[model samples]
Structure formats: structure tokens, C-alpha cells
Target: MQDDLGFDRLLDDDGFVARLLGRTRSGRQRKPLYGPDLPVVFLVGGPGMGKGRLLGCVRHDFGRFVPTAHLDCGAPAVTERVAQRPELRSEVTEALREMALQFGKWQGTGGALPAPRLYAGLLAVATSDRRSSTESLVSEVREQDGLLPPGTFWRGVLSRAVRGYLAALGGLVATPAAVPIISAVLDELLARMSREGTAALKRCYGEYPGAGGSPELGLHTLAAHFQQGGQGRENAEKFLFRALREDIEAAHTSVTGRMTRVGRPALLLDRADNTLGRRLTRAVLEDRERGHHDRLVVLATARREDGGRFLHPPGHADEGRAATWQPADGGLPTWSRSPVGDPGLASPGRGALLVRMPLLTRDQQEREIARTQGSVGTGAGGQGLPVGPGFPGSGPSRLRVETGIRRLSGGRPLFVSRLAEATAAFRMPEEGSDWDLLDAPAGTRDEQEEHAVADVLLDDLVVRQLPEELPPEQREHWLDLLSHLSVAHDADCAQALMRERQAEREERLSAYRIAELLRDCGWPHCPRHFIGDLGLRHLLARRLYGTRAGGAAWREDHTFLRDRLAGEEEGAPDALFGTAAAHRMHHHLAADGAGNGHGAPGAEAVTNYLARTFYTRETRDWCGELLAIADVPLLGGPDDRRARALGAGGTRGGAFHRRVDKLLHVVWLCEDRARTVDDAVTSTLRLLLERLSDESEHGAEVLTRVAGEWSERAGNKQALLPCACTGHIR
Candidate 1:
């Protein structure tokens, strides 16, 4: 059986269970004088942190002593009921009927069934109520009863009957008058289960063919005919207590029966925060408190907020009081000596013992990979290599597993599972993997494999596990903000964007919308508020930059809008000049100097435009490149005819002088292509002055001093021209 259930074997390690149990027990010591009360332990963690695995461990190690019934609050039945609010009349009826049938089958077998038939019955009832098809229900029940006998059809029958009983019980509880009666019945059942053996209770609840009167009295008839005298409500209560006692005794029979008063059953509830509402949590907590008996414990798993739901309500004060194990300064408390007080017990870190589930260490991850892979093959391997071609190996290696973990899981369990699943399904190789092994492309086939894994583990399993009523908007909003934040360096900026979108009246961005976006974009929520990784940042940047509008036709039509406007404004001087300048700049930047080509005309036009507009130093950088290509002087000589014709009214000369100096400064400062600011400035200035008029002795010393000062300021060599005063002809 263990071999058939290979996955189950991995979870049967007692060490993990002991640690969990120890944490639960370390809190408040039970006082023997007052009698032992059931310990309510709540297990909490994010999705995929092993809550389910740990619960399985608990069931395996302490099933007999605890008689725990695991309930998944996120189950479809619970979620559907919470969501739609429809009365589960037929559903509940079918469930109870199924339970009764299963119970009967187990009894017929003398409780020799491999697994607990009663649990199987409960599951069947729950399954039936969930609107599962008859074939599906049968299949599920049969699957659960793997090695059980075929004639155990009575198990199905008894399971149905028990379902009916529970439905009736539910109906009775709905009424104000029968609430206490139902509560007492439940209390009695729990107590009796602790007293008598489960098999004995099954027999007492079993059908009596000749019994008459009310269905409740059928139990009395069964006891009278089968067990002789143990009947009626009082006897039923006693029988329930006896059954519970017997079950506990079977598990811990080594202990003296008299000392059993202090041993209580432990009820562990995992992910209780997923309750449809506070009402369910309160109801469960209250039931445990009212139904408290010696050695009976109720340990529930939930987020701290879920635990508070039970406490905040007025009626459940006592239940809240019982949940006194809270996280404290330094660490969790080993014992709570204080008395149970008002319902205001939930404070920050003041509810349950917070057993944090840390991320699996690298060593642990490697071991898990080795173990998982080893099961597939043979021999102790070093590690699984990364998947892909030319990964330094013919096949997968340990590095592949490590890379997969880093890429997929980011060392998170949930992520690891997701990444593993993705990598398992990943097939296509990214471009250039053969070229550069380290540069694995993201959002590629391999990346998608990683994302798909996260989708399954984190999105499907973890996020979906929340309660149905957890406001779809909130979820969407969280996902949307998370998606943006995960790729942004500034978390505050992402948050601002979310706030802005949310505040817009026309279309408020919903949480669902955000979640959908994140899913679509393959973005994951990072633990850090902002993302800092350059690779991820680049990916996000690409996504943002690559956003194109519609088809190529649409883009062409949009581009034509400007062209149409240009044709309509043919007479506009500003339009003509701007267009000409743009065309000239384009030509200058692209063309070679020969007049035979389009480049020379464009360069000449740009240089002329720069001279006419009196382009600034910054503009000169562009003009300089154009002038160089055009083979034109930026500044004319003083005695040159063009300079005389232009008029040196100090306006043109001063402007040209300022422009030349600024251009020099820019050349000196430019980082591209290696010229330092000083080098560029000196070179361009020297070239300009070489064409300067030799006769214009006006302020020659000033020009030389200016060039020298500028060069010194630029931290490069002095200009080669040595100013016009030197009389050195080019």
C-alpha cells in the first residue's frame, strides 16, 4: 500500500510532525485541576509552504489518538454555497444518505476495513452534496477504499444514511429552539467517540429492520436489539462518550485509564482563514469550546485574521478566549498563564503561535532534486544539470536544476513546484542558446515553462485557495499592482500608477483586471515591494516599449496624417523651413561628401541653415558633423568677401563667436567615440580659427586669452591656431 502511495511515503516522516506538535504543545500548559480542554492549534502559511503535507503527517502519526477530520474550506461545495447562497436542501439530503450507507458497510465488515470507512462515508456525503455525478461519486469512494472488500457496498449505503442524519441535524440546528439540542447532540457525539470505540458507535447507529416510531428512536431500537439496554438520548450520550474513550484508549492504551482525564484530542485546522465568512470560523471555534472534553483537542490552521473572525463576534467570546496562544516578543510563548478574557484577544502577533515556513535552502532544494530524480533512475547523483542544448553536458545536469530553481522558483517552494512543472513541459529552445549559455532568453519557451509552473502552483493553487467572498476586486487590484511593481525599480511609482488608475472615475481599475493583466504578462509578485534585478527590469522595459498600436495598415494611415497636413500647408514658411532643415540634417547624417550623391546637397543645406539661424553651441554639434561631411568652414575669415557681405555688426560676429565657443565645449564634453570635452573643444576651435581673418587685429589678445582660458578650463591642450594675432597662416 505504501509503495502504491509513493508520494504519501515521503510525507510520513515523524520529524516534521513532531516539530509541529511540539510547537502546538509548547503553548499554555493544560491544568489538570480544571480538566483538560481540547487544544485548538491553527496552522498558517502562504500557499505551497507544506501546510497540506504537514497536515498529512499529523493524520498519519496521531490519527488514532486524535480522530481528526480534515476539512478543506476551499472545497467547491463550501465555496459554491458561500458564493451563490442557495439552500443546499437536496444536496444535504443526498450527503447524509451517503454517510449512513458507508457507516453501515463499515459495521458489516466488523471494522476490518483498511482505512476508516466512516471517513470514507463522510467524504462521499460531502462529494454527493457537491453535485458530483453518480459515476464520479462511486469512482471517488472506490478510489478511497482501495483494498477494501467488494461486498462493502453497505459502506456506500451507510454513508448515504449518515449524510441524511447530518442533513436532519443541520435542519434542526437552523431553528432557534433546536440549536442547543443540536449542540448537545454534537457534544455528546464527540464525547462518546472518545469513550466507546468507533466500531461500537457505528453499530449503535446502524439500521434495525424491525424498528418503528421516529428515526431518532431507531438508534434506541438498535441498541436494545443489538447491544442490549444501551438506548434513548441518555444512553446515546453515554455511548458516544464511551466510543470516544475507546478510540483514544486504543491509540494510547499504554497509559493508565484513570490518568486519561488529562489527555485531549488535538484538532488541527489548516487554512481556516478561507472560511466563507467569520460565521463559519466562529461556529467551529464555539463548537470546540462547548464540546470540550478531557484529552480532546481542536487544532485549526488559518491566517491570524481568520482566527480573529471567531473572536470579534459577541457570542463567541468564550471561543476567542480559548484561542490564547499568540506570538510574542523574541519568540512564541511556551505557556499562557493568563486567564481567558474578553473577545478582544486578537492584537498584532497576539493570537496563534506563528510557525513561519522559511524558504527551502539551496542545499535542501538540491537534495529534493536529487531525491526526486534518483527515484526515476539509479545511483546517487551530484545534481541535475540545466535543460537545453550545449549546457556543458549531453543531457540535463545539476546546474540545470539549480538554474531552473533560480529562474522558476526564485527559491520559493510554490515557485519551485511551478518552475519544475514548467521545465518538465518546456520543449522549444530559445534563440542563440548555442551562442551564449548564460543569456537564457526570458518569456521564451523555457521562460514560459517557468511561468507556466508558477501559474499552476502559485496562481492556480495558492491564490485560488482564498475564500470565494474575498472580494474579486481586491484580488484583481493586488495582482495588477503586483504585476507592475514586480518589474519596477520604484515601488512607490508603481503604487502611484495604481492609485491614479483606481481613482479615475470613468473606469476604475479592478483587482480582477490587474490579476488578469499580470497573468497575461507572465509577471510574478515579488516579496520585495519593488524589483531591482536588471534582467527582469529589461524584460519589462521591452514589454512597455514594444507595445504597438493595431496593424501595419493602421500605422501607415496614422503616419499619413502628418503627410497630409504637410501637403495642405505647402505655403507655410515655418513648415517649409522646418521640413527643409529636417531633410538636410537627415542627409548630412547619412551622406558622403560627393555632390554626385544625395548626401552633399543635404549636408550643404544643413550647414547653410545652421549659419542662417545662428545655431547654438549644442546645435553646432549636429552642424559640426554636417559641416565636416560638407567640407565647409563653420567660421569665415575676416577679410573673406562672404563675411564682409554678411556685415560684422558685432551681432553676427558675437553670435558666431558664442556659437563656436559653445560647439567647442560640447566637443570637449561628448563621451561617444572617445573625444574628451577639452580635446574636442581645442580641435574644433583650432580648425575654426585657422580660417579666421589674418587682418582683423580687433581684440586679438582677447581671442588668444579666451582660447587659452577655454582650453585650460576644458582641461586639454591649448588651441593649435594660437589666435589671429600670431599671423600664422593656415
Candidate 2:
């Protein structure tokens, strides 16, 4: 069942997949290639945003074309390989060894990237003690030799190393055969390098306060210190990483003849922000800093945009920035690079390219929906027509269903795919609209055919990604906590919500902690917003509002926020025109507005707030505030509840009510811009301009300008697509 939810299982998007691989639609490689050419490319996105899925696609689609090996940094298989040793550095070595094995097994254009130097260094660390036998060391080296592609490079380097070690020993070893093969090889290489060549390794360990100045002892110290972490541990890790890259360079040179027709070997690191992964990435950056170049491209997945700060320094300008996959002339997604400086270098700036994992554009999503519907066919005794609104394959019905999906998914592939699958299996009545299907009763006798898709989506997108360290009960508590906090606008508001729930005790659930968890799980980080992704936030918010306490939890939560803000406003009266005021009115309307023929909440207060702030803030700023407050996703959709309540002019019959209503009507129109542009909405917009004109005639031109700005900012009418996923890269 879980395998069926695979992104490629339901959609045929090979063109997009090829684009991700830096290939043309016809699967030809792009020159000046960004995918395999770049030393590091980060695929950044939130959980269920398809970062892992993209990696899967790369392996499945392009494995034969490129010499690719994938290692999940978070997978226990990697760390478990060296459980007896139990060191992060050892885990990194194991990871590299696994990659080397994979590269050797591939029958592709790029041959194996043999890491003899790395293997020798690790072997030395394993057998540096006098009690260890030469036979064990020989066996270890021979074992690694078998995994590498057939080459004389290891034997030649090891033979030279053995000769050097014997000469240095000078009868200290009574028997020549007693000397360890790998340790001798590593020692010889360290000595063979020029002073400048070895200086970087020495400097890395120089900061470490540990003893052992010799190269063999240094290797031992580095691997040992990996357990006792600090600057010393990091330096040790970097030293080993540098050795790995050096080996890779030599290996690349050796394999150059075979790799002419292929791109560089790819190391796909999934969940690269994990402990072992971070070390590998940081080492690559440091290697690049020292002007070390290798034909090894690292394609890593990062939960954060700055590659979890390993790719770039803190306070980086492009932090949390995301862009659409705008394919260049080469037919690959255009990427942005931020140069990260290494302080160790005199001229220190090696950049990492950040490539956001692409979300499906609305057109692609609609196509996928249509495709799934066609494949699933009509249920029970119906013809093989697509199942949806109007007549089975009617345009209006398709459009309506697509619009609902856009609202629910915001173009997230997982959400869209699951929803499409569910829609295909369920047969709706001729009179029922897409909304009925989406907001169908969870436990009705007739609709008893389970909402399996929604459940799976919720689990995969939210619950399943939570930390496994959490007790089963605590996981539920945390989910509920996140659901309630999803309504929070920023860190402060989220922290406030946490405090109100008194949930900061056992789990230490705070804004920063939650942010960290969200990031680790591959969710976007909107510093200004909690649960950054809109679709995700809405999903959790839906759970909060619809499921718990029979819908009372929604009002109760909003009312708590309203009362909390009201208290804050009492102490700081001046904050009424600030963020606090906008948030307060947001909670006010969400909590009090029934939208069931009842009057809007605090209509007079809302009117006063808008009237006072309209002139002070810029037109765009005012509209932004209005949208922030008005764009609440109520159970009945954005329109029926919040929009209708705000648009309704209650008994405050005067210029104030009319003026506020006109402005709010503009907000609703923009929020629902994807829907059919009806005459009533258009007429309401014109009424706003006229009302603004009346104000301007009285020498108050601000309102008229504000209305125009709002309309223009909503985007031109004809260009407005069904939802926010309008940026299609075709």
C-alpha cells in the first residue's frame, strides 16, 4: 500500500524527472552541466515535498546513464556497519566504502572510484596496535582491493609504502613480515607528500589538543576523537574527509579513460543533515576551499535551504529562499549558488548550488489528475469515462476538482497524487460537487468507503515524520500541539500558543525546537510563519479544527488567541495598529463569525481598526495585513465563512461600515481569485473604487490609491490561474 503511494507510481512525469537529472527532455546530457558537474547540489524541500522521491527517481531513471550510488545518512544500515567501532568518522568511512563497492558493481560509463588512500588510513586506524597481526592487516587490504574495480593502482602504492616502512623500521621489527601492510602504506603516503601538501592535514589536527604527532597516531587520534566530540573531533573528521577526497581524485585520474563518455560519479546523500552526512559535506566544502578538485559530485537532500548551514554560513542572504524550476536553454532547472567562504583560505569562497525540489505546477497536476481518473475508470456499472463533476469528463467538474486539490495540496505532489487516487476510486452522485467529495463526512453510513487517501497523506506528511524517540502517547500530544500551533503567525505567536497549552514541559516543545524538528523532517522554514508550508499547515489546522472535540476545538483555540491578544492590547494600547492588532482581528473573526446568517464579529471594532490604519500604512502593506487576516481556511472553504462574514455589512449603517466592507471585499476577491470571476465580485470591486473616489474627492486620496493597489497586486484577471501553483516551467 505504501509502495503504491510512490510519486512516479501514479504519474508519468519523465520529462520533469529528466530535467532533474540535468538532461534534456530526450535524455541528452546538458553541457556545462549543473547536476553532475557541481561538486555539491542541494535538493531542498519540506517533508513529503518529494526530496527523497527525487533521489529515488534519479536512481531508477538515470542509474544506468551515470555511475550513481545512494546512501541515506539517517539510515541505520550505514552507522550499523561500524557499530563495533561506534564512531561517526568510522561511519563516514563505512559510507565511503559502501559507495566504492556500489561504484565497482555498476557496469556503466564511469568506472569505480577506488579509494586506496582512504582504505589504507582506515586500516591503519584499525590495526595500529602492536597486538594486531600482519595477516589481519593483509586480509583487510585484500578485502578492500576486491571491492575496487580491477586496477594495479592499490598494489603499486602499497608496495612503495611497504618498502618505505621497512627502511624506516631499520631492524626495529625483527621480522620483515610482521609489519602491517595498510599502516605502512598510509605512513609512506603521509611522508611522501611535500610539507605544503601535508600542512593542511597537520593544521587540521594542530587545533586538536590530543597527543600523537606521527601520521599513524594522528589517524588513530582522529578516528578515536570522533566519539569525544569538539573542535578536535571536527578537525579529525575533516582530516579523514580530505584523505577520502584525495583518494577520489587519484581514482578519477586512473579511471579517466573509461569515464570519457560519462559524467562524474554521483554520491547521493539522503538526509544529509544527519551526523555522518554533515561531516562529509563540510569536508567537501573545506576541500574545495583549499583548491582541491575531484570528479565526485555530491547530490544531497537538505531540510533547510542553506543545506542545514553546512553548505553556507549563518545569516546567509539566501536562507529559506525557494525558486521555481526555471529550466535554462539546456533544459535543466536553473539553480542559484551562494559562495561560502572558508576562513582558512586566503581567497576563500567555494559555492554550493541550491536546487529546490520542484513541486508540480497546476497544469501538470491537472494532467496527472486527468490521467489517474482515466486509468481508474468509472466505478461499478459505469462506462470507461473519467469520474468527476458534471458529466463524468466535463470541464467544469474537472476544473472544480482541480481547484479543490490546489487549495488542499498547494501543488505538493504527494498530496495531489493521493487525492487523485482517492477521487478515482470513489463515485460521487451527479448532483454532488467536488467540495462534497473533499469535505465529505468522515463517518457517514453511505460514504462508508474509507478516506484512506486523506489518512495516508496525514500520516506520511505529518505524523510519520515526527521523531521516533517520542513515546507513542507523546507523539499524539505533539501532533495535537503542532496542530494548534499551526495557526500561529510567527515564532512569538507560536511560543505563546505553546505557553497557553502548557506544553513546554516534558518534550521541551518550543518554537525553535519545533522548527528544528520540522527542518530535520524536510519541512520548509519560514522564519515568520509556523509550519512553513501552506498545505501542511492547513492539513494540521484541519485536523485541529475538524477532528478534536467535535469542532469545538477550532473555536476554542481561536478564542484563546483572541482573549490572549486582548490582554496584551490592554497593557500596550499603541500595539492596536501593529501586528498585534491584525492578529487580534484575525482571531476575532475566526472565533466569532458564524457565517450562518449571523452578523460579523466586532464589525464596529474591525471598521475602526481598518479606518485608523489605512492611511498610516502603505497601500500594499495595508492590503497585506488585510489578506493575512482574511485568508483563514475555515472548514467550509476560504469563502463561505471568513469571506462572507467580512464582506457582510452589519448594522453599522454609515461610511465606516461601507468603507471597511469595500476594502474587505477586495481582499476576499483576491483570496478567491482562482474561482469564477462573477459579476457580483466584479461589481463589488467597482463599488470599492467608487467609494475610494468619494474619499479622494474630499482630499483623502489614500483610500482610492489603496483600492487600486489591491486590485493590481491581486494580478490581472485573465492571468490568474486556479491556484498558487501557477509558475509552470514548460
**Which prediction has the highest TM-score against the true structure?**
2
Counting clashing residue pairs in each candidate, in order, gives 84, 3
Worst 10 residues of 2 by lDDT: 721-730
TM-score of 2: 0.70
What are the per-residue Cα lDDT tens digits for candidate 2 across 22-131?
A: 44323467443443224466776766667787677677666767667889888888766677444333676677777767766676554555555555455555544444
Residue-level error in angstroms, candidate 2, position 433 = 9.3
Off by over 4 Å in 2: 1-38, 84-89, 109-114, 128-248, 255-262, 314-349, 375-391, 425-455, 464-477, 503-507, 512-529, 568-582, 598-629, 636-677, 688-730
Give the root-mean-square deviation of each candidate in angstroms. Answer: 18.8, 8.3
TM-score per prediction, in order, is 0.41, 0.70
